[model samples]
Target: MAKIFSSSLGGSLFKDERFLYQEFVPERLPFRDEEISELVFCLKPASEGKRPTNVFVFGKPGTGKTVSLKFVLSELEEFSDRAKCLYINCFEYSSKQSIISKITNFLGYAVPSRGISYAELFSKFVAVLRTKKVLPVIVFDEAEQLLKSEETKSLLYDLARLPEQQKLSIGLAFISNDNFFLSQIDDRIRSSLQCSSIPFESYSPSELKEILRERAKYAFNEFALDEDVVPLCAAHAAKLGGDARIAIDVLLKAGRLASREGAKKVLVKHVRASFTQEKPVKVEVTSNLSEQERSILDLLKKKKSQDSGAIYDTLKDKFAERTLRAALAELEEKKLIVSEKEIKGRGFTRIVKLAGS
Candidate 1:
């Protein structure tokens, strides 16, 4: 009876919602200028007919690691034809053969799907690279998965040794959430890579606000968002891990909630409601913390607020005061705790407490 396919909703909140999507790469990434410059430095050599320095980019999830590299890769392609950029997710192509086959296909060389030996496939891939005279800059996203298998570990070695073995210019970029992944890799592979490491720090609350505001300008129409909505979303995601994805996703959900109710604007209530739907993401953030960080949070749970000096005194036997201070700084960065300076008699010290207290 009702028009099944047609909706009667009016006053939509979104103008173009794709800006909030993970797959959508914005032309300019806010708060990632340093990381972008470093990526360009590593990949720039390819444009000059020299082998690009291998780079390992590590950071927490949704900290703009993958997106920054993707943006750089796109710019590099536009600037020069000498660099052949190929992006691969190691979770999908975790084997040596599969990855090599992918590179071959990416270079416009097709091989028989079956009945071809890996050595033959690889030889063909190398020949194509030599003939094309383009430096292959292969980005392996989620590269931590590749280290789990001996098969894939060997693939790293082969790629690293390609210059010496095949006399071809090749570049490798690895993206991972685990900061210690390079330490787990083989020494020879590590030595050959001469890898430049770039670390992406979690966004601070203010930085997250800037990011959300920029995205909102593109995603929502004029006056569609309440003033408080971006702050609430940023604070929530900052508390978790300063995950930009969480902040953007909450904004998108809140906009949809407003549209579903035929509301004229997305308000703070919609953002709060969206928070209830992201408990799983909160658990994931908690589970991914280091044991030391978790221990600090557990200690903080017993008190409403504790002096930073006293906290160091309590955990001094297990950790040095410097290490404890660093842990507290990290916790504060994640918005897991808040720290403030206080005067203690003749001197000032920091007072620490769980966030939102």
Candidate 2:
């Protein structure tokens, strides 16, 4: 084989920087200083080995809820050993067992992936905290789903009472996108949590522009992007609800598009392509339908109308005939189509037709 060599990711517009990624936690979060101080004050009690009030942080997506919380926790960990921070995204891990397992894993106890009960994991978690004498500051992002899951009452109740019953300190920080999520929570849980609530508003265009400017300094070369490029990206993302990550993404995609054409500088045209051409919206009547359902729809569009038997015969090689039948039922249930029964011979046949037919 020829000799291989590693090379730098050169001639690229980006700096391989953390500021461009959603998960990066910068040393100081700009534009969120007021909210940062409030969160720190709320979580401050935990550093003194006392339980802080549970907190509900509500905001639109990309409003810096996760970033600010992690920022304070970084400071908390650096100065003291009294509190350990654990952050979980409920959208990805919504079940009681999975959430509990996340806590356990974070605390340095690795539980097996399967064959373990949540009660067993939770008990072990409590025992570890009791032994260590350190507070576990749990931040649940996308907390709306957890509140709505069946496990909500039991899990929250047990967590709230853990401190009193066993004298263990556990703090909770819940982050949600829905403004009314807190109001929808059960009263008993609300009372038990007694959480301090904070809401984050979407960034204004100017605020988003400032944020993009800060990141661009670290993310791009000196003359890579034009002055108008950042504003165009910021304006487009602001229209999409002022998400900081979205702005960064717009810049990155636009920069790459310019680079692809060997252009020396990113421009407003590149930014527009970043918003539209890079990822065009798919306008379809079958938008929310599953792939199989959409495939069946495509077939019906080609074949006009066919009985269930003929439709299945066409798609039988792709999947089981029963699967095709299930897709037909789903389509009818979604009102994407109508099926009528008619006797063909000794058996009844259902003829399928698109909704508009």
Query: Against the hidden reference, what TM-scores do the models get?
Result: 0.79, 0.75
Q: What residue pairs clash in candidate 1, if any at all?
A: none
The alpha-carbon deviation from the true structure for residue 44 of candidate 2, after best TM-score superposition, in angstroms, is 1.2
TM-score of 2: 0.75
Q: Single out the weakest 10-residue window by summed lDDT for candidate 1.
A: 4-13
Q: Give lDDT tens digits, candidate 2, residues 25-102.
A: 877667998888889888988898789878889876778898888888889877679888888888788788888888
- TM for candidate 1 is 0.79
Q: Evaluated with TM-score, which candidate comes out highest?
A: 1
For 241-309, candidate 1 gives per-residue lDDT tens digits of: 688988999999999888888888899999998877766655776787776678788888988789988
Global local distance difference test of model 2: 0.79
Candidate models: Cα lDDT each: 0.86, 0.79
Candidate 2 minimal-lDDT segment of 10 residues: 2-11
- Deviating ranges (above 4 Å) for candidate 2: 1-9, 277-286, 289-357
